[model samples]
Structure formats: structure tokens, C-alpha cells
Target chain A: MTTTTIHIPTLETERLILRAHTLADFDAIAGFYASDRSKFVGGPMSAELAWRNMSQEAGHWVLQGFGRWILEEKATGKTVGMVGLWYPAGFPERELGYDLYEGATGKGYATEAATAARAYAYDVLGWTTVISLIAKDNAASIAVATRMGAKADGTFPHERFGETIIMRHPSPEGLS
Target chain B: MSTLTVQQMLNSERLIMRAPQASDLQAYQAYCASPRSSFVGGPFDTAKAFEKFTAMAGHWIVRGFGRYVMLKDGIAIGHVGPLCMDESVAPEFTWTLWDGAYEGQGYATEAASTVWQHLTNDCQWKEMVIRIVPDNTKSCRIAERLGAILTDEAAPVWYPDSVTYRLYAGAA
Candidate 1:
């Protein structure tokens, strides 16, 4: 074995920052995965697995040039969630996914970080479009998508994650 | 970002210890997919297992040391290594299950010894501690076999009534 480094720019919003994941963020990620709320995004797992997920994020940066960034609250530097591009094996498109911690919701953190990430994807990464594979029954996330100007392309039956709504991103220039 | 360093494969008299692969997920999950897995917090669903599976691999990245998935004839059998789980429960020498058709073959002892040597010699872990649930006689026996002496320390906050066994790799 070899150790490889990944280059990811630290992105900031008014209230949040999209940062690379660290070992310290494992606890919060683990908590998120170990709860019923994790059902939509493959969660409610042991902490050990959560560690793997966070590692994947970092690894993704190295392998894919872009990955899910840990969403941090700028006021206190606490990890509140993760939002970024996710396109693993068998994934159809570069997905713009966001998952917030339990208490960090109802305040627009996901939208803020996701909006910034979308801009970064288009402006810096020069990607034309992104998609978020939202679980069909995940009303909360659908609302977040709508707020972010994402329109439902259609529903796709995912083998592992069940019925998923493919929410397509609007043109970056169109979003005011 | 914690980057996992791929440590070299280790060999024992009978077993090979290597970094886990994506294919080993099923075996690792099945090992803990039963009611008998309570000791290791098992009987979990596939999703959680996937997470747990990833967590073990990630542990290697975060802690600079973690157990290798023990193998016999290229088949994954067990996991043996050091893990730094949390601040309250940092750096543990753990020996876990040797799966189906391969159980009780003394693989645990061989694998543990090999890993102990690797950590003590290569990784420079001064001493290693094995955390055991008080009633986990199976693990207690393995800890004793590794020459780990029981220590009178209070249980780490994670699991109540846990006992600790200490091993000094320097002495060996």
C-alpha cells in the first residue's frame, strides 16, 4: 500500500462551509446513519460503517475529483451535514445529494450548501447539469429539491434504494 | 481528510492477513448477521453491514492501524487487529470471528500473534489493550492465550461492565 492525496477546495456559504471530511466527523455521521431517519439514504448503521462512508467521501475526492463535502456550520465549525456530487458504481448521473443531521434541519442549511455546491460544480468544475436521486417517499428532500429549483425528471426504480425520484438540476444561469 | 495507507500483507504460520476488499463485505456481514453476533453487535441489516464494513476499512485510514481481514487459502475467515474506536475507547487489540467451516481451527491465535507482532514491531504501538465484555469468555480465553494480562480498569464509557486486558509487545 500506498497513500494518495486528494485536492479539494474549501467552499463557503454565508452560514455554512463545504469542507473535506475528517476522522473527527465520524461521530456525527455515525449518529446520522444509526437513526431511522437514515432509511432514505441507506443508513441506521453501526459507527464502524459510518467511518467507511466518511472515508469514501475523502477517497472520492482523490478518485473522482469531486465528492460529497462535509457540511459545517461556520458559526461554530460543527458538522451539520454532507452535500455534493455522488456517482458511484452503477450510478446513472453525477448526483447532487445532501443529508443533514437531526437538529440542523428546518433552517435551510441543505439548500444553502447545495446551491453553493451546484454553482461550484458549474462554475469551477464546468459541469453542465447535476441530479439528486431522492427517495420517492422522502417528502422532506423533495421540498428541498423544489426550493433549490430542481424539477422531477421522473421516478427510477433503484435496486438497492427502492423507488427514487430523479430530480434534475435547472441550468445554473437560470437559478436567481 | 484521513487517507488510508495500504499496509503490507502479513503472514502467519497458517493464515494470511490482508486489507479487506469490497468482495469481503458479504462474509463480514454474515459473520455478524446472526443473533449470536450480539457480542460484536450483529444481526444487522445489509445496509448497516455495508456501513460497518466501510467503517472497518476506514478505521485503517483514521487510526493508522486496524486489523486485517484474516484469510485462509484466499478466503476471508476472520478479522484481527488494532482499532482506535473513540476518544474514550482508543487503541484496542481486537480478535473477532473466524467464519463458517473454519471456526475453532486455532486461526485466531495465529492471526492475533501475527498482528501483535506487526503492530509492536512495525507500527510502534508500545502496548496493546484488548477490551472484552465481562461475560465474553470466548474472547477472554483468546486474550489469555495472547499473553494479555487482565487489568483492573473501569469499563470504557462505550460499553458498561467491560474488562480490559493488557499486552506489552516490547517484552515479547
Candidate 2:
């Protein structure tokens, strides 16, 4: 049986446009992860790591009917960062994740892109629950999660990320 | 300011806010349909849940701010955003995790904190309130975590069903 590839297209928000990843974005992705300043921004991702990450993002869209979109500047057309859904093996659960360059911080892009992706997920894809795994000490991320209406349940120890907070957003139907 | 677009009102760690679509109905319906879920008033039917989602989306246009649908991993789990209370008291901070499987996962706090930050920091709202029913210990605890205060004041008669309530307000 031939499997059909699901095509999740680029989504546009008020300030940013979420689109599929392309090889052209490599330089921008590399620049962000390669910089020491990017440490606190999101990942300590190296250039090669960022490339792998982008590839994985594209792969997710094909396998999972939904995935993160590469965030691009509307005017400059620069790939400032990435934000969207990521489903890894052993963890069939859907997760909301993001990574932005040093220059992208403080602009509310993370929040903006995330909010749009969430709407698409709930309203479009019909996902019942969404999770965000953040390092406990990542104060900036914690603040972002709070802003998006995510509530932290508890901390889970991750071999790779250390102690991470598991934030949950159930479903709108349950909200009073 | 241009009526806060779904994008403008949204605040999340990794997703953007947008208008609701028909596609979210199934996930939302499943949550409301679940028996184990603890909604504010209780479980809701599909019609009611849809109405609520529409109302929340409309609030962004009517009140300039309101609750928003939450997205994670390309799926809609629940909603967290600003909501108007009676207007007589401080604006209430509200949230709900409709999916039973999602509970105890910390996503509620994660999502709610974002809305709280927007209200306090971005929108510059003076005070925020979280009213919790006495029996709902989980909600009461959540209110406490957000730094809400419990008062001796009698529960408002409006919600006669609410036997007891605690008021959580932001610091002045």
C-alpha cells in the first residue's frame, strides 16, 4: 500500500509567517545556534545540530499530519527561528516547542507563533491535549508558557535535559 | 489599537494564537465528553463547548481580549486567556484542561501563566482575580499557587451552587 504524504502548509500570523522548512534556511539556522548568545535563547544547538533539527521538523510534517513551521520574517524573509509540534519516538504524545535566535528574543515572536500553532492544532487538527517540556531553570521559557495559558504540573527528570517542567493545556471544551 | 487579532492576543511558549476553525471541534468535543474531566461547572456537551469557543474568540473582538485556544504538538488541548468576570470585581484569571489524559501534566499552569503575564505586563491590567469553589481543591490549590488570597467573605449568591469560594488577587 502506498502511503499518502500529508501536506501541512505554511501558516501566517499577524507578524510572522509559519512555513515549511527549506535548505536555504540553513545559514540563518546555523547563525543562531552557532552563536554563544543563543545559549539562553533556546538550544545550545550547534550549526550541525540546527540543520538536523530543521530536517527533523520537515520529517515530522510528513509522518505526523502536523508539525512545527519555520518562522520567517514577513518583510525581510529571514528565518529567525522555528516553532511548532514535535512528536518523537517512544513519546507518541504531541508537544509544543520553539527555538529563536538571539536577535529574535523580546519581540514576542515565540508567543505569537506559538499561539497560532495552537489554534491550528485545537481548531484544525483536533488534538485533545498538548504538552510543553521546559528546563526548570529556564525562567524565560517558563514565563512564556505562563503567558500562553499553560500551567505547570510538576517536574520530570530527563536524561538529556535534566529536570524539566511538564506544562499541560487540556482542551477548550473543559475550560469554564 | 486594531482589535486584537487572534495573533495579537495569543501568548505561548512556542505557538501563535489564531481564530478557531471547525477542525478543533473533535478534540474539543472529546475533552468535554470525557467523564473523568473536571470542568469549571462540570462536563459540557458538544453544542455548549462550541458555543464557548465561539464566545471566547468573539471576546477578542468585542472586549479586545479574551480566552484563546491552546495549541501544542499540532493539536488543540485546551484554552487559556483573559476572561471578563462580572466587571464588578477584578478580572478573573481562568483556565481549563478538558482532556482527562492531560491532567496532572502541568500544562494548565504552563498555559495559564502566559495569559497572566499578558494581562499584568502587556495589557497592564491593574488586578486579576481567580475565584475557586471550595470543594474543587485542585482549583483552589492552583489559585494559591498564583498568589491568590482566601477571604472570609461569603460566597457570592450568584453562584448559589458554589458552597465556598476563595478570591485570588494580584498584588497591588
Candidate 3:
């Protein structure tokens, strides 16, 4: 595996700014995961869990040449959430994933940021395929997957959640 | 609101879902030829099957939605889609694979159910649709298992050449 790091100072969308997660983002990131809202977004990620997740995301950039990005509000500079690519436990391939704070729901930020990441995966990283695994009951995520042009390949029994869907996207060269 | 990243869609599991490559074409072609490929018009010729596979992949870039080539042990077997079919009441559920060797295994159900959950719950799609050919007993069963309701309505004219079909409806 080639370990390449691309310093993305900031990735701008209509309403979001995708950047690297910094130590300064800890408190806000922790709060987002600690709230009850985290359950719906990502199911009760604790402060320690959030910190670990952030650190792991940062590690992905260094180790895999790509990783999840910290999402901030461009207008306010507030840390809203995090989204990006990383290997989920047990997955045979690299998967696409994301999360947002309670205050971030119902906005198009997920779609915008995810689309940018997909583009980066293909155009920058030269990936041919990307996958997104989502819980069965999480409708918000399904819509985002659809809007992003991902298709459901099937489902698998999850250790925590009963079952989850696996969605796929083709690279610029096209689908397999 | 924070922007969404591709990572949010993944959950920790034994297998990871990713895109298919050109090298997968031959294996995919063989999959389409398998007897269990019935759910997706099994027993297909390689040339035509490749055409269909490429078309589905194109939808990812053009429509922002398309099928994912399911992988296991580094081989392509089946596919699932957050598909949008106009013939029914709404865009609907879909899944298919080529290997009989992989059948009876819960892989299809696992992948489809995950995507469906994301679509209805996380994505907030209000209504979704799925249309199965009347003869495709396996697909019909799978759709029913997903809680898709069968409809009496006849399929539209634009549908690919197929016999009678049962429409299944679900929350968007």
C-alpha cells in the first residue's frame, strides 16, 4: 500500500468547508458525539470515542493516502461534524462514510461534502470504486446515497446494528 | 450544517464495499452466465452482459446513483441498487448476482437491507418502488422480505421486455 498524504487545507462547498481535523476541534467534536443527537446521527459516540475517531481519521490520511475530513461551517468557522473515507471493520474494501452534529441535520451539507469526497477519490486518488454502508433504519443516509448516485449492492448483518446496506459508486472509468 | 463525507455511509464490518474494475469484467461476465443469475436475467452472453454492466456503472456519474459490484474474496458476484425505476409508484429496491456458489448465503439480503435502511430512515425517502417479473420467484420473495408491498398495477410500456410483473411499494 502506498502511503501518500495530501494536505487539504480546506475543501469548500456551498455551505461547508471540508478540512483536516485539528486538536482544536476536540471539544466541539466531543460535544456532537456526546449528545443524544449522536444516536440518530451515529449512535451515541462518546467524547473519548469521538476523539479516537478523529485521531483515526487523521491517521487514515497518513497511512492510506486518504481519510475522513472534518466538516466546519464556512460562515461561522464552527466544527459541525466529520465525513470521509476509511475502512470499516470487516469490510473487504475501502468504504465511504460520514457523520454530522445534531445542529447539522436537514441541510444539504452531507450531499455536497460527500460528492466532493467521491470526486477526490476518483480524480485525485485514482480509485475506481467506493462503497457506503448504512444502517437499515437510517433514511437520511439513504437519500444522501441516492443523491450521490450510489446503488445498493446488498446488506450484511452487523455486530451492533442488526443489518446494514452496502452501496457502491463507480469510478471515472465506469463500473465493474 | 456540516457537509457530508463518503465515510459516513460505512459501518465496521468484515467486508468493505468499493467500485469494480476492468479486470472484473470477465468474472462478472461469468457470473451473469450462471444459473442463479435468474434474478437479473441470468444466462446472459458475455458481450451483452458487459454492455449492461457498463451502463449501470455510467449511471453513477450521470445520475449520481447506480449499482455497486458486490465483492467477496476479491471477486465480483452480485449487485444492489438505490435504483429509480419510473414504471412503479416510486423509485424502488433492486438486487442481483451471478454466482450460484454464493446463493443461499445472506450476502444479498445483507447488502440490500443495509442500503434500504439508509434510503428510508437516514435518507428520508418518503416512498420507494420495486418491480419484479412475475416469474422471478426469488426476487419476488426478496422484495416481500424487505417489506415491499405488491401492487396490482400493470407495468408501463417503457419497461424492458418482460412478462407480468408485481409492483412493490414502500415509504420513500
Candidate 4:
């Protein structure tokens, strides 16, 4: 019985390193889910549920061939957020998502990380276009999407979070 | 950190236990929707079920090992293995039959026995634990047959109502 291992690709930006998640990231993940900032992303959940959520993100890569990555600051080697491609069940289409930890947002980390993720989706995975599902009230995220040249295409109603705005990014050709 | 890796597939006389895959999500979602899933926190909506399925696969990446789908004749019937969610705790050896059609066939015990050896012999795990709800007689019976001793330790804080059992590496 030979053993098998999985490899999650790492993406690099100018200042951030998007890499596979480790168990070591659980504490930082739990902290994000516990804070009010996580509200738009289906969070403010218990630490136990948070563990499951992180694992879900990691598994997404295996099941889908591409998933989210932990955003690490190259200078400090600190985990600042997560950004990547996502398309879970019930979702209308594939998405490019991003989330920044407390004290990490003002620096455009989400935009920077998300640009790399979107490029991977379009250039590497050959995806034509992608969308981001942002809570209706999340202006900061909306701003990030705007900066990425995404426009409000439609809405997706979530069971727990109410109506969400689906912002569509530029097509692969449009980006070039 | 030690790199923990488990065999992708384990073959028993009557079952093939393998790691969960992308193709297994549909069956898992169906299982979660059925009444059979009531015991293990199921009957989830499609969204939640998808989350659970991905999480199951991610557990392997996060902890270097996770549950395996019990494939009977190439169909995924259920999953069995040790799942360690938190680093501070022992991994729980869990087993489930996704559909009622697969129940009462003694498949759980067979697959479980094979998994036990893989974890103990191949993976070198010294201790294993299981948590079962008091009313889940079938799961309780499986625990007993595996030589897992009923322990005074409470279940994980998240599942307080359940009872805990422990099986040492050499005891089973």
C-alpha cells in the first residue's frame, strides 16, 4: 500500500505569498472567524466550526484542482489574509474571493492578493471570467472588486447572510 | 513537523477503503440529505453538505490523514478512519454507513478493522478514540467489538452529550 500526498500550488505577488494552508494557521483563522469582520463571509462562528471551515477551504483545492491560499506578508512572514478561487455547492458560478485579517486591510492586501488569484484563474486555469460574492453592506470589499474592474452583475441570496452582490471581473482578454 | 501520510487505498476481503475524492461529493451530499445521516449531524442542505465534503478532504491535508470512503464494488457507501480536528486531542476513529441499504451488513466492522491496522501499524498511532451518542446502538456495538474501552473522559467540548471510548494500539 503506497502512500499518497497532495500538493497545493503557491502563488507569489509583489509583497504577499499565497500558499497552502497548514495546521499552524488554525489560530489565526479562528481569530478571524470570531471577529465581527467575518460576518459577511458566513462567520462569527465558534472555534470548532472555524476549524472545519479552514479544512473545507484546504479540501476545496483537492476536489476542484484550485482553491484558496493563505496570504503571507513576505517581509514579516505573517499570515495577513486568504485569497483564491472558490466554487462551492449552491454557488451560481466560480468566484475569486479574498479576506484580510484585522489590521491588515488598509494596505490593499485584498486587492493585491485577489489580482494574483484572478490571474491564476484566467491565465493558469484558463478560466474566461470569475465573480466575487460580496455582502450587500460590505463597502470595503465592494471597493476591492471595483479596483479589480469588476461590475455588479446580479445577486445571490444566501441562506444565512441574505442577499449578496455578485461582482463579475473582466474577461481574460479584457485583462490583457 | 513529521509528515504523516496514509495509504490511498486499503483493501479488505469485502471492501476497498480509500481517501475521499471529488467524484464522491454527490453520494456524500445524498447521504447527508437522507435520514441515515441524522445520527452523525446530517440531513444538511446542499450548501452545508458541500462544505462538509470539502472539509473532509481538507482534513487530510491539514492533519496529514483523514477519513476514507468505504467503496463497495466501486460505489462509495460510507467513510471510516481517524479524524483529528484539533492538535491537542487524539484523533477519533469514526465510521458511518451513508445509506440504510448498506447498513446491517457488517461492512462497518470489516472496514474499521482494516483501518485500525493501517493507523496502528502503518501510521504508528499509539492511541485512538471514538465518540458515540448513547442512542446509537450500532455505532456503540462497533466500538465494543473493536475492543475500545468505555472511558470517563467526556466527549469533545463541541459534542458534550456524547460518550467517549478509547482503544490503545496493542489492546485491540
TM-score versus the correct structure, for each prediction? 0.64, 0.47, 0.47, 0.94
Chain A only: list TM-scores of all candidates.
Answer: 0.94, 0.87, 0.85, 0.96
Candidate 3 lDDT, tens digit per residue, A95-130? 888777767878888888888888778877888888
TM-score for chain B of all predictions: 0.86, 0.76, 0.74, 0.94
Q: What share of the true interface contacts does each candidate keep?
A: 0.12, 0.00, 0.00, 0.88
The lDDT of model 4 is 0.88
Output DockQ, candidate 1: 0.13
- List runs of model 2 lying over 4 Å from the truth: A1-3, A37-45, A174-176, B1-172
lDDT of 3 by residue, B42-115 (tens): 67766455545544543332233445556676566767765442223455456776677777777777766666
Candidate 4: tens digits of C-alpha lDDT, residues B1-172 = 1245577789999899887888788999999998878777768988888898899999988877889999898899999998887667777889998888988989999999899988788778878889999899999999999889998886766677799999888875
User: What's the DockQ for every one of the candidates?
Assistant: 0.13, 0.01, 0.01, 0.73
Candidate 2 lDDT, tens digit per residue, A7-101? 65889998899987665776777787778645543456766455445544554554455777889989788888888886644342678887776
- Considering TM-score, where higher is better, how would the candidates rank from best to worst? 4, 1, 2, 3
Give candidate 4's error at residue A172 in angstroms.
1.3
Model 4: CA > 4 A from native: A1-5, B1-4, B155-157
Residue B118 of model 4 has an lDDT of 81
Q: For residue B13, what is the lDDT in candidate 3?
A: 42
- Residue B35, candidate 1: C-alpha displacement in angstroms: 4.2
Pick the winner on lDDT between candidates 3 and 4.
Answer: 4
Ranking by lDDT: 4, 1, 2, 3
Q: List the residue pairs that clash in candidate 4.
A: none
**Candidate 4 chain B lDDT trough over 10 residues, lowest sum:** B1-10
Relative to the unseen true structure, what is the C-alpha lDDT of residue A20 in candidate 1, on a scale of 0 to 100? Answer: 72
